[model samples]
Target: MSREFEIAREFEVDATPEQVWDAFTTGTGGWLWPMDAPEPREGGTGPFGSTVVTWDPPHRYTNRVANVEGIAEQTLNQLDYTIEPREGGRHAWVRYVHSGIFVEDWDNQYDGADKHTDFYLHTMREYLTHFAPRPVAFTTLDGPEASKAADALSTAVRGLGLAEDVPAGTTVEVRGPDKGLFPAVVDYHNPYFLGLRSDDALIRVFGRNHWGAPVGISVHDFAPGADAKADAAAWQRWLDEVFA
Candidate 1:
């Protein structure tokens, strides 16, 4: 069935409004996955292939994509960001909206997008707080077929010494790719999403079993030695062992 949804969220980040503006226009890699640089003016193309609808530096930027492929019923996909400086410009308040018209696999597409948005935004705050301006090495990998099991996500979290009920802002220990163990904070958690942020990275474990798919993880590594392919392979090995 066709569905329309708007996800509106407001959060404070430990960054200036200018830094927040760069996060959307140029520095997305510091928070979200990297993308081609978008043109800076209205009528220019955005990094995600959307047309820039509005562009006002450090304040408002909106983009829209029309007639998405493979989704014949889709009409529009738009993203809007509004930033306001606060606390003497030491921090910023961000308002984000993702509104779209498309087909919905309510169990997966709609809900997954909603929850993943929270995790990504949480990562944005984490990045601005601890690792801003450092380019991150981001990589994503899918787990083995066994990861499709209902308990798959819970299993991995337990392996990290965390319960699904762990509250955010709590500190915990998690195994690193090379180091024996490293510290991370529970940045965000929900039934379908788990986010952990360490001194130099953000780790997101997605529970996609509900979508009839394998579980997956995305790492945003900002350490000086970060390498995307190498890091992804290392995590792939860990995921395989977790579900084996």
Candidate 2:
């Protein structure tokens, strides 16, 4: 079965289309778009490929992205912007058209398309609105230290009996199933965790599971370098009360 869906949303940004175009075209600002490496040029290879189909200053800019994962082996994702002169300035209308069959499965394709559209629009908004240069890092846990941490966290999760307490709060705005479903007791390898962010810290609570049963506990900690002990204790108490 073949299925297709389209998502279109508009945002009233504080910046003009010219400014928006520049930010998107510039290498430094392109990260907001989640492009691997965006090199804006009429026909120069970059995230999408070589060739700028349309580059009408401020008002419109269009490019084609080839080989987008799961989509067309050579697909064209076009972005068009229109600026309408308003009371204060120009109101921008950004339209994205993705044409390619990246996936054979209709469900997967629709889901991927939905996420891509959302991310694209969100990145645009972030750039034009709350542009923050936050530090992000990635690290893998391995060896003995990693094992110890995992064990401790696992133990804590088991002790908490988390399955009983429903996780309630604002969903993690990040994309993915893990973000949408929280406080759910899942399988051992796919346990549920809660993510929290504050002005001072970002916290991740790792849940534990036995077979497919959830033990209502999680090992909580502030982002790397911050104290975990306090956060862990706090999470423990919270879980205790929640389960109680």
Find the candidate with the highest TM-score and give its number: 1
Which lDDT tens digits does candidate 1 get at residues 170-215? 9998875543588899988878878898888888888988678899
Candidate 1's C-alpha runs over 4 A off are 69-75, 177-179
Candidate 2, residue 188: how far the Cα is off, in Å? 28
Provide the global lDDT of candidate 1 against the true structure: 0.83
Candidate 2, lDDT over the whole model: 0.41
Superposed on all Cα atoms, model 2 deviates from the true structure by an RMSD in Å of 11.1
- lDDT, residue 213, model 1: 84
- What overall lDDT goes with each candidate model? 0.83, 0.41
Tens-digit lDDT string for candidate 2 (29-147): 32232333334545555454434666556665556554454444224355444554344665555555544433345565555456545544554554354333333221111112222
